[model samples]
Target: MNRLARQSLLLAGLLLPVLPLAAQHVDHAGHGASHARDPMAAAIAAPSRTPANVARDKYRHPAETLAFFGVRPDQTVVEYSPSGGWYTEILAPLLSAKGTFYALQPVGRNLDGYKTFLAAKPDVYGKVKLVPFPDQLSLIPAGSVDTLLTFRNIHNMVMNGTEAATFKSFYDLLKPGGILGVVDHRLPEARDSALEKTSGYLKVSTIRRLAQAAGFEYVGSSEINANPKDTADWEKGVWTLPPTLRNGEVDKARYLAIGESDRMTLKFRKPAS
Candidate 1:
């Protein structure tokens, strides 16, 4: 081959691998730019999600929150107390194709609503597995789950005095090195500890201590769901904020302007033995 042809061929071969990397970009949040799309985004954007739930996306940050949890479509996951199946609609279908999704709702809690939600759409929820927690945790093989998620429910557990049992169950259900993603209303450390029981907010130290006591290592935390406007000292607790706004029309606009509770997103992992 001519010298010019040989030089051109060499340059083309060197550029092939770099071309793919160059085409990809990383966003400020360190997601979405690299790839043309993310499965979690597609799941969150699915038309199957209710308009009400979709409207809450700005406050919930499902895509960034789940991604922070490192959720994948091909892992065995458990969502504790899926409360009204808000995340269920996204998780069930995401894992439906290649992974296992177990909804660990308590029998007397929101289980009925969860059932009705799943029943309403067989195609989206066909692969979901239901296991009543505390009562039916045994149904999920011990140490087999890849990830366990509990969003905005820890305070309820604390209020009901079930946090220890719940955390122990979380440890037992996860495999060694398995992940635990927790999202709950944030209560500043300066706030009265008594508020956690009735106010629907919790201190991060409280959660960390509880998780570590149950034998899980602190992984990290994310601010994807944080809302600065929330003062965390509402009359009816976190519920006094948007979504719940338990106070009715009294000061509704002010609460609406404040938006959802400021939440702390945390991740923990069972020690890999």
Candidate 2:
């Protein structure tokens, strides 16, 4: 080969090895660009879901709750008692491609209203699997879930005397190192002995004990939704506030001033063997 031709051939040989690295960098950039352009990003970024949804004011936790539990866009999550699917609407789409979202409820449970809503929005609701548990969580295989989340539902379980069984089922469903995130209306510490089912509040200590009995380690608690203004003394309970307005005008302004109920953000973990 001539001198110029030899030089060009040598340059080509040198460039070949570096090409793969350059291509890898480009691929990574494209992947990042795709994530940036994702529709869920825009939805999560929108102002309507922030602070809390006005239409569904019950959820007002700080962003730290999800962050603390290491909840990513990709993970199998089972949400318990997804009443009205307020958070479900957010989680289902967020985990659409990268993760799975399952709503576990008892079979024969009255889900007519929720089913109708889901039927209307197939695109959004299709992502969720409504797993039915006949009487317990026997329907879910053991060690199959990544996270189990119950928001404002523990009180109901406690009131119904199902807390122990429910938590045990939660423990059974999660894989080792899985997380359980809970947020619920906080009852006064003093009321643990006296508060009845009608109170709409739960003692944090009682909740901790119940979770511990379920084979989960109490990770910690967060002040994400704590409210000092609430005395846990509402006549209509937590529902007397914004969303439910249960009492229907006796102290509308006074209760509205309180916004949503003060809640407790708790994190629990299943130990890794």
Query: Against the unseen true structure, what C-alpha lDDT does each candidate score?
Result: 0.90, 0.78
Considering only N, C-alpha and C atoms within 3 Å, which residue pairs clash in candidate 2? none
- TM-scores across all candidates? 0.86, 0.79
Model 1 lDDT per residue over 1-273, tens place:
999999999999999998667656433335544332567766887779999999999999898898899899999999999969999989987887789999999879978888898999998887889888778788999999999999999998899999998999999999999999999999999988988888899999999999999999999999999999999988788888889889999999999999999999999999998
Weakest 10 consecutive residues of candidate 2 by summed lDDT = 41-50
Q: What is the model-wide C-alpha lDDT for candidate 2?
A: 0.78
Give the Cα error of residue 38 in candidate 2, in Å: 8.6
Record all residue pairs in model 1 with backbone atoms less than 3 Å apart, i.e. clashing.
Answer: none
RMSD to the hidden true structure, all candidates? 7.9, 9.6
Residue-by-residue lDDT tens digits, candidate 2, 91-190:
7777777888888865555466667756777876787887765455565678988989988888888777878988998999999999999999998887
* Model 2 clashes, total count: 0
Relative to the true structure, candidate 2 reaches a TM of 0.79
